[model samples]
Target chain A: MAKQYEFRIKGLPYLLVLPQMVIVFIFFFWPSAQAIWQSFFLQDPFGGQYIFVGLENYRVLFTDESSAYAQSFWVSVVFAVSVTVLAMSLSLFLAVQANKKIRAASFYKTMMIWPYAVATLIAGVLWLFMFNPNVGVVAWFLKHKLGYEWQYLLNTGQALTLLILAASWRQMSYNFVFFLAGLQSVPADFIEAAAIDGAGPARRFWKIIFPILSPTSFYLLVMNLVYGFFETFPIVHQVTAGGPGKSTAILVYKVWRDGVVNLDLGSSSAQSVILMLMVIGLTVVQFRFIERRVNY
Target chain B: MKRFSLLMLALLLCASTVFAQIQIDWWHAMTGKNAAALEELTKRFNDSQTAYKVVPVYKGSYSDTMNAGIAAFRAKQAPHIIQVYEVGTATMMNAGGAVYPAYKLMKDAGEKFDPKAYIPTITGYYSTSKGEMLSLPFNSSTAVMYYNKDAFRKAGLDPEKPPVTWPEFFETAKKLKASGMEGGFSTNWISWIQLENFSAWHNQSFGTKNNGFDGLDTKLVFNTPLTLKHLQTIYDLSKDKTFIYGGRENKANPLFTSGTVGMHFESIGGYGNFKNTCKFDFGVARLPYYSDVKDAPQNTIIGGASLWVFNGKPKEDYKGVAKFFTFLSQPESQAYWHQTTGYLPITVAAYELTKKQGFYDTNPGPEVAIKQLLNKAPTGNSRGIRFGNFNIIREIEDQTWEDILAGKISVKDGLDKMVNDGNAELRKFERLYKK
Candidate 1:
């Protein structure tokens, strides 16, 4: 009799997030849990029999030298960091240019984002054609036009550079979109204030604009690093096949080769769990140490 | 009332008789030109006799088709026939009661199937350990060298003569590259053609007991000086920009046909595509060897896939499949298929018929593959690998080869690592079965 109860006010947040939570549970969490469970068992593909091996699989994962899981981890770290830095630098430069009143800005925007709209697999295929020593456009240009001897497939340094470039090319667009949005959100009044205080354009950008955009930069850095490790496999397989030797054999590709192609679920799963823990720990450290410095 | 009841009963009997056309499903991975031929064969069979209707379904690539079949089987809805690659042989063989061997099925269905009628080499690969045919060899191919005639002419080399030894191959490729060709040489399935088949072609064991002939206890043994020599040459060629390594697998097929590469090593199954696509004349030759083994001409191993009959089909459908197998075995049909597609004649009779027809004499290219295959009888290792989880072993080999070419690891260490890793995979597979 005293108080009227409101149904909409208390349960609104839950209602808003219920669909996404359900989706995450079903698609991501459930499959991950199942893979973890399978890592502990030996599965018979013929009869669907799974026998638990306790920590035997984990022990094998640690002791398997032929797999070189440790080497893969190190390679992945280097690949992730280099790709993140390169992609971030490029995208920031593009965003800054697009923000200014430049000629054909709209056309430039479309051209910059065009690669992002293409599928990763298709991009790999196109890149492979361009790098083909026999018929690749770039190979033709390098050898015939420039008169420099080049074979991207056989050279280790060149192959790795090609992988980084292809990876960065696809990623820079996503970074550009985020940076552009962040740039737009940066208050014009703040830049004017900095200028009035006798700061130059470069100084205004470095001190005033960059610090405000730190949050977006940080977000892009973490996401890009994770993607460089985990998501670049299909492209790598299509493009280099992790060659001119194993120069491009990063961690996720190793896990994929061990798991799907090799059918050694135990070692592959063990690698997956370790990789997950490493990523999670690194992410936590970043948030603890770096998140505080993000101005937003 | 009695007359009306009798009439109704008669009508019910007529309705049940019309629903008796036994339906059978076949899931295959044959696509492009091969698919067109398969459709022609199935259509002719369907029109010839109306006893049973065989429905053929295209299910993408070999691995994709097999995965789909396995999933469907678990769902209790697998096709009557599934085309599985040779690598999946051990998996199917270990799948006890899941598959009905062709001979057993034919016999049980009151059909005659003499396994001896097939080529000994062809049947041997698909047979059980006891020499019983388990599956039908549908489209088998082996690695062979394809050279551009125009490139050879431009390089001032003999068009009819191909490199018989590895040294000659390298020298010739270098010459072609120097003559301003796009690329002197490019190879596909570098792992399979250059390493796995290279070891087998030389009669060297890639693993113990001729690449796991004895079973899961097999260990790697390919870290030899000869293999090192072969790999070192490839690395040197890359430095010289004479020999180009294609991306992976059949990625280099188009390079040869597009006139971008002077010479290429690819599967004979790709012959159909090459023949159609190559604007300039091209020729086929047997794979080159290192000129060391006593009996090095022991024939190149096959690369294409075979068809396996699965269980869970109706009794009447087995009869249709067996009859279709017999029809496909006819010499004229085999010859036609061999001439149209670049796959080998699957039977001795087909080979004889093709020779009598002077098909090889007219077509110099198709004869090269046959002469190479029949050059020496296949032994255990050269016959083909059928180890449990051999697919994984192939992947490990692929990774190891990549490492070797990258200069990240020496060939000896790379192959040694591959062997150790491959054996571990086999042992894990062995453990799964044992436990």
Candidate 2:
């Protein structure tokens, strides 16, 4: 048995971590608390006047089906889930291939990882140019080469598809780096032993390699979900601007539009408070259920 | 030696007092050529004065500037003068103690400011119901139709005579589409051109309480039979490919510039850009009206930004601001800005000066804006509409309008949804101010 070590100086441990705690408290907890406090009141833009009305803002936010909030909720759901699953799976597949014995391995890996260096807003704008209906190269090819009508500006489904594709394409690079690292860290002896035991390649990957990568997979899953929830706002903003009848209006986009653009603070704050709760619940669920299956 | 040094320091302090000029902060959202025009005006003002120096700072886009100004005000570091867009007028007005009304400022400074000296239609949008000027009008524009004269000629229609009625306009559009054009006429600002200005031009109220001018208890009334008819007609035309939906908010401008479409509706301020970019001949015409409406084609409302002064500045600053406004209202400066920037001249004297200089004859495109705005005295609806959250309301307008064209919602339902959502925003604005 190894020696078990414990810190008897409780004050020293708290003192050592005090700086990070202060940073998180000031940056995260303070603003979240303010958002929750502001959600119950109808406020002006400059906070010149605020009238308290308990739960009225939250009620109005969820009640307006015709106001496009319902559609936005559904869009946010589909957007987050699809982007997380598609980006993770696709990057993982590419990472596995890039991990194999192949020619010019670093070149393929570098090419795959280059998109991570591009800003999310820049990525969105580049995709927008490529998919522009009138003069874009992709649009022209789709119409002239494939003989298909690609009208994203007015088509609801097409707008969402383009938004998801742009967001997923941008997200895949980040996922690829982690997945490649995780694949490379898997020991070589397990694979050779499984191969010697007469197991096929599919069986080895599913039973051994996949189980070993669960820690990285779980971390990526949590990260991708949180990112899908909040960080895609700029891409949605520059690309579609929550148009084509609120089809691409994600929840965070609505928060910015209402709070920042329209100055509807109460509704915006209520939406953000809901988003805060959602993130908290997601983190709890992921750590409680998913972490149990993740191998150390 | 100490006595000699003290005497020298006293002399230096006296010299510093004589050279110091009061610097007033002026935040604006003008970019590119517009910023250059504003800089020239500032240079002229600074050169003519010794006691005050005006400092103009570019603060990003209109929305960014407005938000920055508001945030600054909250921090008690607000600029002396902030240029706010027309849509931001309502929010600025409701800022209450944060704003120093232009009329009050002029009176306090004892400047010789006449409310009647300014164009009624131009100032009407920025004035109270009692005709009190809230913010000084700096740059103003109105909607006008720009048609490809070459496309009209190819369609066997008279280039000199553009369509005056809605029926005639659609007929001409169909003809142009048949004449080998890619699509029919598209519009730049669909909500402003189709709904807001549409109701005003037809002498129909956009909302109760004089389009939110009389009181804060106003709700939108734009879903009437006539407006519904117009929305439905546009929807049908879009389905038939006679009216191309070229995205929203001036994204369709290239359609007109590239000669992909026949006619386009855009702000009169776009004249300079269109002149530089268009490869074909274009003519400016008044927006088409429905013949059946009784008092159709009322004057168009202004669409550009205005200069607003914030409160809590020193009294000396207000006096300098008044002097600046006095200089800005001069006919020469107004005409120079008007001719250079393509925004309308706010004062009648400047208009006359530009006309006397034969500016209209050389540039025929801008004459249509003045003519359309002076068609008749503005009624309650035609004056202007002011409501809170108008920016997002415009987004809602664009989205719902596209939804109608996409067949997701009927025209009637879409129009109703717009009115419903718009009224909800208005109610929120009312609550914010009424408190």
Candidate 3:
């Protein structure tokens, strides 16, 4: 049965919603508007002088290959996709195993979620130390014992891989928590019936639990994409700093490097505007396509 | 008892109202021991005067400090002073009405100021075409070669003798390698130490318009044969691991400190950090030159930050800032700063004071940078690079250098690409602040 609730006063409803709207406008809309506005003008870092340059900032970014903003776009795509797929699948697997009624399952679940507590930048630093070529425990083992060279310093692929691993490791816990909840909520009877009907464990789970977990999966997918794009900036900043040579300069880091570090206000603003549009387009596409598959 | 307590409270209020110290906020980028030294210096300044309290706030890295200073200026809450790195000089100088020129501040405050009293090379960097000082030269450093004496010993080379020329440096590197060192040598700051200073050291122009001093529309001219040959030598060395490419910036520092590399090039300001970290006996020497070029091994340019006064502060605050700057320039204060931190003493008096005290006898490492800076009177190109968007340009240079070394691009092509790309950035800067 659906329960209908009504506010006592019309003014009360507006009052209740006013604070959220104001917060959103101040934090999100206002800065976004400013970014869009600033994109049209060239200004010094001090905001002392502003010259209107039309769309020159955007033109420079799009045309200048050496600036590497275009390269950052592809880097971000690979980074986001790799991070999303890797974190999602690994967490799903871990959640599935932890879903069993084994002894110390709660302890195992808690241990898996511990990485989620580390801040992104801190996690990056931790991962950097662990994978540092000079004197890292893992790096030492790989070099001395396995005799496989693991130098991320100059290797673009290895650097990106290490960053992706660090990024995915921190996020796995959050995905695992959601996946475990989704797994626990799956009706046991449906699973049992599918098993009784001669469907194997893989088929039964795929047909039954997987589709039922679609809602969670869709939500995680969108969140993970956003996380991959924006939240991974700290990790990228700390780990490689877009280095080995602009090989990992993702979009967000470019925006920060230009705007904050180099004080290129106009270009960074343009970048942020483009980044905003890109993410918005991405979210819209996800909801349109991915959400349609999420039954119930 | 209540009446007596009320009387005491009234007295305290009167005291607070009567004696108010003008708080001069000094935002700086110095960290660790340098920051501690700055704080102590600030305490000394505060103790010496009752009219002003100079509070030195450590504002992250140099870039972060510059950003914060600029952002705060926009908000009309700017500090009295901010330390800007040498590369940021162009950006800071171009910000009209955003900064109060140091000479003007000193003149207006009626302070006994003489720009020539400071080291010519130091003041020459932060000055205008008229040779008027723009900002107070605070902490300056130059590139120097830090050699591991133990590695030299292991290589059977004389520990006291370091390479004097580029060819000799490479030869020593070969010797180190033959003696079984993992990496013979490496360098830090591919863009700064290697290219920019490399040009100046060899009496060559890094860019046109006297390295952006004459005009904003400066074009890079460092893609010459000399620069190319230098890069080629490093590239060839890197092929055999005689010269290990240590990522970018100071990332190669660990290679030297790890003791596997014999000689490393870095800022002399790294003195404090190296002392703390290096387990082996290390010695600092002048950066090697080609030795074939005329006036080769000319004075190197300064790195590190300078104290810049923000615009639009109250008149009294500017006066206090002027006074505080005067305090920092005193021989004792400058010598202390020079000794405590690895940064150079900007004034001749401080340098003489330090020498007389025989500070160089024990800490000869820092003297190399000082001597490098003062080796010869600065020429047009040797004054150091001053171009806007240099931070971004440095990144481009770093990326290009790495690409060339990694064999992704040929040395000539990479240098050409760097020049082309860097010129575009300079054009952007020229357009932004074009008069």
Candidate 3, B1-435: lDDT as tens digits: 999999999999988854587889999988778888899899999899789888888889888898888889889999999999988999999999988999999999999899888988888889987788999999988899999998899889899999999999999999998888877899999899999999999889999998989999899989999999989998999878899876677878888888868999999988888999999999999999987899898899888888899888779888899999899999999999999998999998999999999999999998888888999999998987888889989988998887786678999999998899899889989987887
**Native contacts retained by candidate 1:** 0.42
**Residue by residue across A124-236, what tens digits does model 2's lDDT show?**
88988898675567976996699887878898788888888888898899999998998888899999999999999899999998888888888888888888878999889
Model number with the top lDDT: 3
lDDT values of the candidates?
0.78, 0.88, 0.90
User: Model 1: which residue pairs collide?
Assistant: A245-B402, A245-B406, B141-B303
Q: Rank the candidates by TM-score, best first.
A: 3, 2, 1
TM-score of chain A of each: 0.84, 0.91, 0.93
Clash number for each model: 3, 0, 0
Over B1-435, each residue of candidate 1 has an lDDT whose tens digit, in order, gives: 999999999998886664575666889998877888888877777777777677899998787787777778877898888888888887777676678898787788777677777766666777765677788888888889999988899889998898888899999999998888766788998767877678778887777755665566777777788888888788778766587666667876766787767899998888778777889888888999977777676767776777788888778788988887877787877888888787888888898999999888767676777777777777776776767778877767776766666667777787777777777778877777663
- RMSD to truth, every model: 4.8, 3.1, 2.0
Residue B190 in candidate 2, Cα distance off native in Å: 1.7
Which residue window of length 10 is worst by lDDT in model 2 chain A? Answer: A287-296
Query: lDDT per residue, candidate 2, B248-312, as tens digits?
Result: 88787877887878999999999999999999999999999998999997878878899999999
**Per-chain TM-score, chain A, candidate 1:** 0.84
